[model samples]
Target: MPNGCDDQLPNRLARGGYSMRVRFQVQGLLLVLGILLSGIALAAKAPVLGEQLEYTLKFRGLVTGFVEMNIAKMTMAVEQEMGRVDENPAIVTDLHLTTEPYRKAEMIYPVRLHYRSWLDADKLHPLIAVKSLKTREEKEELLWFDHSQGEAYHYQSGELQAGSNSRPPKNLQGITALSDEQWENLLQAHQVSIGGIEALDYISFLHRLRSMPLKSGKQINFSTFNGKELNAYLVKVDQERLVRAGWNRPAFRVRMWEVDSESGRKGDDMVDLWLSDDNERLLLRFYAERAFGAMEGILETGRPTGGKDEGFSEATRSSLETYLGF
Candidate 1:
């Protein structure tokens, strides 16, 4: 009986130790999982605020303009007629494109265009977009997108003469304050409606590209509303190594083209874009053939580190400029 009691004592001790081990293992796993989740949340929120990208615009291998892209935090508040207010945390992106003064390309038609897009931070859907242009004449246009109703409202301030055309209209202080009847009257000719699930404008489309999962050999399709009409695009993605501004990096080469709005047939206007294959997904290079000639935009200061190059021989550049009447 003494020997049997001693055996049961060891068995009980062994069971107690095993139970403690199992508890410790589970606690360790939970701690690690919590840490991983926290890390992911921080990473997702860190790089989004106050980020800016500057690009140098080149036409026929000569620096002609500059482009600036900025992202910032915003709050979108919309008040309905019944005193109900919808406030949403939002992200606002601003893109400014300006031609260098007295540059050969600017001699013909100078351009100073500013665009802003307000988007829902969580869903990445656009809420409003503003287009301000200063070419021969200055004009400003605003587009307020209502995805809930699948409609977009357009407002324009005619031509802002000379004095009052400096800054954009204050946010939510203008068109959003109008009533439904006022908006309906304002939407007579400028009413733009979604033809598909959703439509993005120029600025929102660029922001969407950054948030998308771009993998090699992937094809993405979407529609864009360019103030007047709905344009569909099919984009093809491929991974490639690109060299620019003395920096060579792996990039996602995206080729985009338009499709027929009605038939979905392939159309014209092919544009090529290169984005860094990193967490930031920077726009390293942009190439589009315009009516004037081939226009290109490269990162002003390349990723990681960068150095500048003229990208064309002096004689070749001179000859091309002369031919293009620059």
Candidate 2:
């Protein structure tokens, strides 16, 4: 439902490397957590809350030696209600991703999310849509454009005669057709970072942490409107053994720092992400180490051949099943 915390950032990252820095510090530490956990799971115990979830993203780096570049599997469903300020309010979240690579060929993206909270205009609106089907064939040659605030529209095939078409004729532009400041410097050198579903509340630790003095393995020092200054650390892994899928799942080790922002031209890379203390803190995996060789591929199966009417609604499926307690 967007509001994942706002600020929108994330496009994609991990490719080519050069800069490096890491520091650590720990003491006192008070608050920095963001809550968003649910409850209700007692069939055998171990499920405070859950509506519907599914994930499968395997990415092994190294183009020359360690292959496996793609494999995206996703299925999400969350709903909860009663919200003016709070009290368990989470609605709409139905994602279905199916990507493949390992060798080549495979793509499926079915996303539908809707969230609204006005409370008389307090502001909270998130609506994402990507569902087009007509038996494919590039869906008439493809043609959708949003670029962020163009609103939203996608075709990629044919049949979208508004005023006889003004600009929706790219066909299937690649490299995102560049030019948005060169696609935002190629999405900040692929370190990509677009609102991460709205930051999901920084990774919810039960919410309530905004002090900011820097503790728990401190390092801080941030900057990234393009100024680039990075250098952040703070670890606390252990959210139910981090669930698990592959690679054993248990890393968010945190404790990474790298600074160089006086205008030296180098700071488009920063990898260190792990957050899975269960309860749906979910992020659970991220590790990159590949400077230039680059050449990997992995993705075995994927479905959603056409697009199931692009779903969502029943009051956002009962508010994501009561904030994810499916």
Candidate 3:
């Protein structure tokens, strides 16, 4: 996310025509969102708390950033004005995303983000999501998702309130004249439907993708509510191949695109994902074509912090440690 929440880089903005500012946001979201890593075999049906997954983000083959995602069960006490207790089983995800320069330096990197998402443990629907980013300036975003009502609310705050001071469409400039796509985004902005398994953010979508039975040469379309706008993604399952990660084994190369994909259509600007084929199904490689170039990432480290081996193989666990040499 950019400091100027308005710099929606890859929000359907033409690829080659991206300004330097949009380029930064595109890289931020590409790395921040899909930096999500999950297993080939999810132990029970839901992720247990205290699970940590880390990935090394790269651009054009160079390590540029790192993303760490952690999950934990949170209990929210609904107090009566009289201080009564009402507990709920909720899971919260804390994500820390930062670039290489920030990691190696005392100063801040141009693109750095820290965000957390709280979801209903049983349903995997989000309750609240907050994100903070530091670029030319620092900005914070808050989103609340009401699945029952099928609506998501967004609030922006920061030292520099870039897009926060937006006026209604009638008073705002360029209301009558608009592109069809832009109009669609505007109309679906705040009001959205959560019917069935739709309205998922990319992080939630990644988790949901794991359970889906994606057979070879199959494609599935799903709706995603990206806080800023509503969009759809077409996920295509390509042939399987052996990709080297913690181990050299068979994996599925999945392609995803946010476009109007019709039958037998592969849309432009795709995101590529590789997941291990075995039951220990771990995320292996992630790649997405960005405005500047292709943004790439790989699983760097993963382990059950609870001193229990759910199913990760010895080779997979050991190989990750060797790859993270100091």
Candidate 4:
């Protein structure tokens, strides 16, 4: 992840392959959708189906990327080994991310990534996550979550579709590309075991977190799948604060990190986040210590699904300026 796009995964995901990617090329898109998008029906503690949060991506001090979330009526088609399931009355989230040319760093052309997620209407479990990416490189990933059977399905685009710049490591033993006649057989869905893990894809993790009671000094731990590996994560409620966050609402200062419970050694990546202190629990701001300096996401503008822009309070803007050391 360090070499690739600094995707919206746990800050640790940055240690992967490529300079242009910090996140999963496919589910980095999927992760952001889960991490930031919300559903409308479940109540205020979780994201409403019609709510959308727009964010600005900053690296060091540059506004290099933009990401936005929009949740609408759930109407996407999803299929699994079991069969097709009707997602009517489901919750759907769409995410879009774009980055400007980092010409000075050899990252010339801009990049765009798109992701979609569908969740069950009542339980809010992830049904499927789909990703599409295009830049100097082309990659796609799709995820199927069948929690009922405790299984996960994954797919990564074959190298044939890989951009001239990216040659994904071969998972086919010593074989790389297969003949066209054998292509369909070669490109098969890979499976990861998640039978007992309470795993949430990147996007759905936030929803799960929102549903928790983050009382002061409480610690929450869970397992999450970042497509490739299933890792454990910890979210602790460090304390509560009275910052206005530009609005008059109170906020909670929380700490998040990865942990190896067996060894008890902490992870290198760390995240400090601010969430609304009320039932809404919006993720107001976060600063992640990643390989490439601090990756910051600030709320720029947002609205409920089908609603108009709900402007950010100037105080929130000023707080960001001060927090970023502007």
CA lDDT scores, all candidates in order:
0.53, 0.26, 0.49, 0.51
How are the candidates ranked when ordered by TM-score, highest leading?
1, 4, 3, 2
Model 3 worst lDDT window (10 residues): 69-78
Report the error of model 3 at residue 223, Å: 1.4
Candidate 3 lDDT tens digits, 44-158: 2444456566665543211222212111111111112111111334566666666533332112124567666655566665666556666666665555666666666655552
Off by over 4 Å in 2: 1-136, 139-156, 162-164, 168-175, 178-239, 246-282, 285-326
Q: TM-score, each model? A: 0.64, 0.21, 0.60, 0.62
RMSD to true structure for each model, in Å: 26.2, 24.2, 12.7, 11.0
Model 1: per-residue Cα lDDT at residue 23: 34
- Model 4 reaches what TM-score against the true structure? 0.62
Superposition-based RMSD of candidate 3 using all C-alpha atoms, in angstroms: 12.7
- Which lDDT tens digits does candidate 4 get at residues 1-326? 01123334333333344334532332233243333312122224645656666665544311122212121111211222121235334456667766643332223234567766666656666767666666666766666676777877666666443333332224321222234333232332456678877777766666666666666677778777666667787777755443322433346666777889588667876677777666777776655533333444555443223433334323334435656564
Comparing 2 and 4 on lDDT, the stronger one? 4
Clashes of 1: 0
Error of 1 at 237 (Å): 0.3
Off by over 4 Å in 3: 1-44, 61-88, 100-109, 158-197, 261-266, 302-326
Q: How should the candidates be ordered by lDDT, best one leading?
A: 1, 4, 3, 2
The runs of at least 3 residues in candidate 4 whose Cα sits more than 4 Å from the true structure, single-residue gaps closed, are 1-44, 61-89, 100-109, 160-186, 242-249, 302-326
